[model samples]
Target: MQLQKKSKKISAIAQNKNLSIQFSLDGFSFCITDLTTNDVNLFSEYIFEKTIASPELLLEKIMYIFANDKDLQQDFKSVSAIHQNNLATIVPNDFFDRNNLVPYLKYSVKTLATDFITYDNLSSINANTVYIPYVNINNYLFQNFGEFEYMHHASVLIDKLITKIKNSSIKTGFFVNVAPNLMDIIIIENDKLSMYNSFSYSCKEDFIYYILFTAEQLQMNPEEFQLTFLGKIESDSDLYKITYNYIRNINFIESTTCFFNEDDDFSNHSNYILLS
Candidate 1:
């Protein structure tokens, strides 16, 4: 279902704005930015009390937000949606084929003949991010707003972290992006992506198990490597508290360094992808 609203008549000057949305079955959040001044016009997240069981419901929730959130019902120079799900994996440039998409994801994730497959190029690492975009969600957004760019949230998360790794003195470390129901663990070594994976957790025990397990697989020492936290997390949150107990030399990505933060209420390290 689509939201009912009159077409917003944006003046020619309105093109200097952009909308960024990141969503999954767990939650939905969006932000609007004034490109001319590099300022954020608005940012809001619609929390889901429990995980939505189906795509139809998720789409309905998004449509409801678009109908009520006055900030979302505006014109923009561009709109980009980030699909946050574990149905994504990375492929080295040498093995990537434009003619075939299913083979890349077949082993990593179960795919059907009907699943719509797409990829995002990771030029920074000479690879491509392959995954399933929300075809239904894309159709809905396209139906209302016309053509807009979209990609897996992992694509944005990995690429942005790569830039940070290259510029930092530290090379090898773990970067964990925590959201409502899932977390992505990205391992970097010598300024290159060593590993990238995402996990779903329902409790603190499950959360720390994934991180500790990943570290064990890589033989990474808890006391040596510095870990950086990002996305919807705080120093006192259960996730951070548990992580700090297991990992040493932990820190957050400063908000001042974040390009998309203009609101005092927004956490410096939260929503790293949407604000990017």
Candidate 2:
């Protein structure tokens, strides 16, 4: 019998205590920062682009490079992978057996963030059976893989949103904006979550209808909650205009908790740019 040989190159950095890493396998770029850190370190950053035959190999190889760090060695809790199709997997340990993983996972999508899968939105997605909505829409209308992370980018954003939701302790009334292509929203409240709706439209009117439809499902009104928008810009396109245009007259205010970063320069498109 022959074994499959891994084919890949890797790079890594030991993030400062104040900085964590945000890597997009699709974009081939990684950004590190800690929101609570000092202003100087927060502003200074690094980024790079490269490809790997397998994204997991890139992570294992990079972790090997950072093996000297005691914190990464000890506190390493979980490993999760998100896929371009917006599906994700959460692994308990990096070295766990592979054959045991598939049956346990009914759906398979690659991951963006390496560890830290225990957070909110991801945890919900990880815990439940995610049903992908496949309608007869023409996929070719959009750019072919313009910047879709095979797994990790959206996972990272979901993780941050989950963290924000968990920490804020705000319940019963908040809106979350999401990208049209990714997974559907899972409303988190009182540490429990349930699927809200699924969509594939980039137009605000489409989203408004969807939201209204969701509200109808939940037996609520569109004017009752605050609105939060995600993925406002895709690389160079200003999508927020369309997003805001739909909700402009509503009394609901926008929430910054979903807008994790203020830096507009990050490569919002081209998921292939994420560094492995």
What TM-score does candidate 2 get on C-alpha atoms?
A: 0.42
Clashes of 2: 29
**RMSD in angstroms, all models?**
4.4, 13.1
Which portions of model 2 show Cα errors greater than 4 Å?
1-28, 33-84, 88-159, 173-184, 196-198, 202-205, 233-276
C-alpha lDDT of residue 163 in model 1: 83
TM-score of each: 0.89, 0.42
Q: Tens digits of per-residue lDDT for model 1 on 22-134?
A: 88897888777778876666677766777889778888888888778777777788888999998999999999996798998888798989998999999988899999988
The prediction achieving the highest TM-score against the true structure is 1
At residue 102, give the lDDT of candidate 1.
90
Which residue pairs show backbone clashes in model 1?
Answer: none
Q: Model 1 reaches what TM-score against the true structure?
A: 0.89
